[model samples]
Target: MAKTRRVSEEIVCAAIRKRKKRTHVPEADAPKAGEPRSFVIRRGKYAPMLKDLEKDLRQMMMPNTAKELKESRKNVLKDFVQVAGPLGVTHFLMLSATQRAGYLHVAKTPRGPTLTLRVLEYSLMRDVQSAQQRPRCPQTMWHGPPLVVLNNFTGSEHLKLAATTFQNLFPAINVATTKLSTCQRVLLLDHDRASGRIRLRQYSIVVQPSGVTKNLKALLGRRAVPDLGECKDVSEFLTRSGYGSESEGDDPDTTRVELAEDLGKGNQKARQSRIRLHEVGPRLEMELIKVQDGLCEGNVLFHAYIQKDPAEIAERKSKEDEREALRRQRRAEQEENVRKKESEAKRRRRPQDDARGAKRPRPEGRVPWG
Candidate 1:
């Protein structure tokens, strides 16, 4: 946990340092000849309105930076030294209290009671697990009951997986309730952590976006996962046999159509046309079991509480959200890949389309033959 905290502090420091240099216009402050000339921040003349930009940037970077950045640099230093909530002490301790006091620090705080901190030699440790997580953040262990699966053998597997994913993403989901993808990304981070971290561990297997989550209230209402094992994550177990139908060489369009037919109902055939809970359920369960089993086989961490520290929790949640968003964005991008492949397959399967396509008249300068 301490290491995780340390990792978090380092990350924050790096981000602040990075944001500090985010939009630096070295040109704005560079010396044309010899003197480091100071010029009034010229709005719209020599540079983009830097003062406002800096203010806006600080607002996001600085703690609750909505108001005027009335804090002197000295305040930041003081906060670091005395009221070092999460930031370290020495980084702000070895300082001249007089010369460089600026808006950074609100006010000089009396130093806390002295305590010794022994610096240790640092070495890189490699993680070999399969879970996903931030570069290295705390784990969010969801100590909950095992998932319910009275439906089928596949149901047990997927329910467990969905349960783990539910637990893994619970925090992220809370933070980004309005955004499902963000929560999903956080869950994946847990998977990465599962396979990698030595100190912090994560669960394996990632659940698909099933009604498992969107209808969590209903599931919990019905008392899901009554006899769940004392497992950290459900990874080591069986994963859904294959990812999607195509990974198993099943046609997705055919799968979708078959699914629609299986759930056919009277009066509103179109209503059941899209993907259904039953259609996606079996696949979801398989993934759950695979991931759960993986975790059970000593590939998981058993901290129970993923992250207890509020600061770490907040930071990790932010990371989970950011990571998931990227994953979804990447998935969206991958959809383009799926479409490209599908398009090519269509071109191949229906050479007639290609022939017909070639025969179409060109609209000057388009596709050679638009």
Candidate 2:
């Protein structure tokens, strides 16, 4: 027998590095339209549900966002913001919980217009998968960002801003240049005007050849030979109507689409395909609580419940200004003290230098000429 080949550690590591280089998207190669990178993080103590939700959010913002970002209680918003600029991260999705409710803070990096949303209800991915009979979550589904669909997010100024923020979270797609195969997922944000809440749902996009019986589709799959043990003939097997077949009474207008390109094995160009959406969850019902002028803080631009009069707003502004001035004065005083201490240390060092240079009284016995 031939000797078994042994791969050295260095060779394995080099191969891994090479693979990473090929897969990694460098900042220089990013599209001119600017693809937004994000950090989906949780702050403080959180329930298991919220932690899972954070993971699902990270998965939804795939290819560009950090999927396995670790954060501790000691880490602050500023720490992530400081690092985001260098790494080209543009958005932050921070989840936090209190005794009353859970909150999601969506903020643009290093700046203002943070949207605070209260989570009314949520369902994790595991929960949704377990409930479905056939959960479809292929690994290829996460290779690209989901297509965002915003419904009924118009009319109000706050709604418009919220819509814009959600749109900016993902890279824009050019229909002419974009390939159909890359669109593996869909993110739906439906705003309920009556309830004043937004429903978030993520789905995996699947295309199947339309106008084909289930038996024919299975035969084309070729993964395994269908068991024809009970059938009398091959024709009977192929023309079987109700043998382990799903309901196919779906509306043609809503589900059918013309394939612009060859998407997969059975989905060929110009072929009629049926589009189906499988909910891959972390579903949420959220209400916009407030929109702030800064990252997680600063003046509130919009509040759902509370309304402050102009006088109260002016007073608050004045108080903020006064506090800022006080902080500036204290910083200036600290700098002045630091400068004075440096000068004092220099003066002390000069006297020490003089003492060292006294020259030992010029050696009392030595003549001045010598």
Candidate 3:
């Protein structure tokens, strides 16, 4: 039998010549559902599949939806608590429906775009200038007309907020629009020409309104009516009376920290958790936390999950590395000194040739007669 011929270089070169992209067998080119079909790449055309794949990827990654849900279910307290830290009970306890929606969305919840209990306008309504012309607040089912409520709430300047708000700010049943609080119903500005002094006088507003008969007492006192808290879709803010500037104050950045903690500690143990491993600074910044973000999950576990005080950690690490370098430099210096001593000793043991070390000293080496 004739021996098998060896493949020649020209034949091998022709075989190795680049083929058209279409002919090249791709690893896996199965078109998934909702994917576009592959196209012919001719005349050095750019690969169309890459753009499609990239577009598909972009459509796939939603920035916050999943993360928000995972975070909010547990981190709700951390978020609200940090909010509460700055606001008073009245301000903190209450949030308008719109505001509440914003908070939930900020915390990454999908409460909105569903049942939009949007509060058009929310505040104390104090005036009913005319029966014909009255301010109407759209939110009537729960709050009635704010003017009526303000009539019930607005007391003289000196009186405490709680006492005045309950007495004057109480809603009147005569909100024909169920929107405007008529002046008689909410505003308590009574003028008397009989006493001719241009002065504003304080009125008697009661805090412990015991023994007084209210127009709505029958409905209010009834146990079946349920507290305002139980009112469906009612904002807790409408119930509270007063607020102050001190409600907003210097507060720590507890949102990120608490959120990280709650998700880690609660019953839901995500794939990763943030736990303190060591302390770096005066605050709890140095302690290592297992970052829950998807990007940090794989190779970065041992790399130190640092979100806070990064500058400080970097500076400290830099100093440490520098110290090590300095130590190494000192060690090298000592080694050089030892080598020098050895060389000097060897030089001392070696004999020197004569005629003053051969062909006389160089002129540059000679010293002038002093």
Per-model clash counts, in order, read 56, 0, 13
**What's the TM-score of each model vs. the native?**
0.16, 0.78, 0.14
| Model 1 clashing-pair count | 56
Q: Runs in model 2 with CA error above 4 Å?
A: 1-33, 46-49, 224-237, 240-250, 328-370
How far residue 132's Cα lies from its native spot in candidate 2, in Å, is 1.4
Compared with the true structure, what per-residue lDDT tens digits does model 1 show for residues 1-370?
9999999999998988775466653442222232111111111222232234233222212121122323333343333334333322111111111222211111111321111111111111122211324332212111211122222222334333433332321122133323211111111111222322111112222222221222332223343463326434433112223222212222244223211122212212223122312110001101111121221221222233242566875776688688879999999999999999999988787977667778546577667545
Task: Summarize candidate 2's per-residue lDDT along 132-154 as a digit string, tens digits.
Answer: 99999998887777899999999
RMSD of each: 33.6, 5.7, 31.8
Candidate 2 Cα deviation (angstroms), residue 196: 0.4
Sort the candidates on lDDT, descending order. 2, 1, 3
lDDT of each: 0.28, 0.86, 0.27
Measured with C-alpha atoms, the lDDT of residue 366 in candidate 3 is: 55
Q: After superposition, how far is residue 303 of candidate 2 from its true place, in Å?
A: 1.0
Rate residue 4 of model 2 by lDDT: 31
Arrange candidates by TM-score, descending: 2, 1, 3
